[model samples]
Target chain A: MALSDVYDFYRRMEDENVILSFKGEFTSELLTSILHIMETKMVTMGISPKMKKRVFNVLVECFQNLYHHIEATGDSPKQIALQKSALIMVIHENEKIIVRTGNYIPSNGIEKLKERLSFVNGLTEEKLRELYQNRLLKNKLSSKGTAGLGLIDIARKSKNKLGFEFIEINENTSFFCLDVVIE
Target chain B: MEILLLEGSAKTPEINFNQDTGVLELRGRSIPENSIEFFKPLNDWVDIYGSSPKETTQIEVRLEYFNTSSSKCILDLFKRLEQLDGNSTEVKVNWYFEKDDEDMEEAGVDYEAIVDLPFKIIEVEEI
Candidate 1:
């Protein structure tokens, strides 16, 4: 089988309709460019103004997560390597916008990620609202990295399940794909 | 009193405040790397301006986007203005949002809910 065949199978199983595909070094410039393009498209498509903001907000959070957790090796081998990766966005027939982002994840980080996803996925809408309000009241002044509330914010905004899949690339690394949908 | 103008970056917004005219404006995105560090001085300036209240103080906020932390700081700023209600100064807040941007309009309403001040939500065409 060819590489496209593998991608096709995975795409079918994930129930994603790939409308845009990109693969390159995930630099800050590239991320911002992508956001700008997406925002333009959202406006052109006549998406509601509220939904446009929501889409942009979700994109920023997801891209930041990929940047923070990407694996790398060099002079600073253990440093979070700002390497290139593949990002795919799909618009489902049901009017749901799905974003699939893939990046190299350290093998040891899988369990922690799973735990966080599980905790976020278990919350009801009311519970998530309470958590958000509580965080706002008690933790607004805290810095971003220190709080690690990005995942919770994503969960609350998306109002969808966080679906993830891992492919073991080698013993020390794995290609992790995260799927988030905005309906 | 001096007018300090700052441009917006990928993380922050453009800040324009004129002490002479008492016209303060913040527009564009706001997701600064450090929320407190970025907003502390702005808050301080508002406090200083509130002391010797101007005859007509107008604050225009036309932010396209801001993170939750920045939202709190904005609330604090509005509260400060609300405190100067009976003073000789006439304070007015004009929150501008895109014509179809309901999220921004709702945010304006949310800020209005907390402060007892003259706040107006204006819809503008996207430039």
Candidate 2:
């Protein structure tokens, strides 16, 4: 990338009040480091203890979603599963914090994800709480035990409808973008 | 029997379960990428503790932050405690949050609503 291009990118991020942004391989260790970084940033910014905790909690759910849903590549079955070049941004908009994640997903999975997103976005706060409790009690965690728990948790914490977009990358893949706003 | 003691990590919580006093404490941050793997042992210990529980069981949760996965696992641990014979084993959960951490307090309330056991949301001076 040219220096001018890099400067333009930074300017855009600054305009968005992006406190933290990352575009790279998503690993477990990276997630830990990102949380630490975010915590320190929030503390330095003098965010209220309660709001900082809320932002941190929402970020955790977002990072986990990126880790679990980002499509893995390679033909070898023994290869390590890692998300290559996922993007995450924590932006302060007005008095709210917006947690955004962008990653590629298999085309086959996009429909189900869209349905889940729309379902979560359609509910009121009371309904969201009800659904979270119901899922916690009844839903079975898949082999990894993720099983949409993160989504429900995110919805409950944000207390706002989820926003998402699907950008087609190819015949078999699309870039899934999710945004959570915490007031 | 033996006590369960696990040190806290950057991404996991410290678990201290006393077989004698029946005071199980979880402290620190819990954002492990795979929380189920980290919490399975804690959940299993609760199973054993339930079978031969103390008269009064106090579980203290002092987490600064926990991911969605750990949230589910924590609930599982609490659900296990709920299975203990209420007449014989009395379970009380004290959830501690930093002062003014309304989100954490609300989280405790949510957990209280989900589990049948007694849960108290306590505010600490600082994390």
Candidate 3:
């Protein structure tokens, strides 16, 4: 990354109205600190309390999704390297805030991830609420104690279909990006 | 047994389970990195509290935010209270939210739908 390249990226972030953009390895400790920063930032902005709460909640779910997915990756040098470069960006636009995260997913997992995203985005509000309720009752947490409720909750909170893309990085892995927009 | 009081941190909720007063309170943010571990003792406390009857059990939840993992643990805690509700123990959950926060209020409503316990969604001027 050249100095000019860094400046260019900074300019682009500013152009996009990014409030925060983080690119690095994500650990549980780092997640807490980032959340604290976000909370303080929201408070400083003096946005509506309800809006602040919505953005904060969406950010938490996004960070946890990244944290859990990264932890699930086995200890391969390449995977770890890829994990360290994961990106999260929070942008404010058109009276709405957008929380976006990008990370690597093993090729085999991309299909399932896409399907789940599609399923969540496809549901009507009533069905989504029903699904959330049923999942709350029946969805057993994985060994990591995540009940796979992150996506559904994000959808519910955002009240928008999730935006996602999978870029083919290589034969064995892909870059997965997810965005939730909160109004 | 004894009262269970755990201080809140940046990532975990404050838990004050008073066996004597039957006023169990969970407050602050609950986005702990290891929510299962953080909430284990609370679950165990609920189990013990459920077994021993109190004339009235009141749970006050005033969380600013919680991640998905913590949400599961919260449901588990509420389930324990629901169990107590069945056996003649008057269990009530006072879910508090900031007056401007409809999302938190809705979260309380979500829990109310899932758990068969009486919930009082109270809106305060500020948390």
TM-score of 2: 0.90
* lDDT (tens digit, per residue) of candidate 2 on B1-127: 6899999998888989997999999998988877778888888888787778899999999988887677778888888888884957899999998887776777799899989988889988976
Give per-residue CA lDDT, model 3, range B1-127, as digits (tens).
9899888888888889998998999989998755889888988888888878688999999998888788888999898788888585799999999887777888899999888999999999876
- DockQ (C-alpha) of model 1? 0.34
Collision count of model 2: 0
Which is the winner by DockQ between candidate 2 and candidate 3? 3
Docking quality of model 2: it rates as medium
Q: Flag the better candidate by lDDT, 2 or 3.
A: 3
TM-score for chain B considered on its own, for each of the candidates: 0.92, 0.96, 0.95
- Candidate ranking under DockQ, highest first, comes to 3, 2, 1
Please give the DockQ score of every candidate, comma-separated. 0.34, 0.61, 0.77
What is the Å distance of residue A139 in model 3 from its true position? Answer: 0.9
Per-prediction interface RMSD?
3.3, 1.8, 1.3
The best-first sequence of candidates by lDDT reads: 3, 2, 1
Query: Which segments of model 2 are wrong by more than 4 Å?
Result: A73-83
Query: Which 10 successive residues of model 1 chain B have the least lDDT summed?
Result: B31-40
Q: Any runs in candidate 1 off by more than 4 Å, and if so which?
A: A1-16, A69-94, A140-147, A168-172, B7-11, B31-44, B47-58, B68-96, B109-127
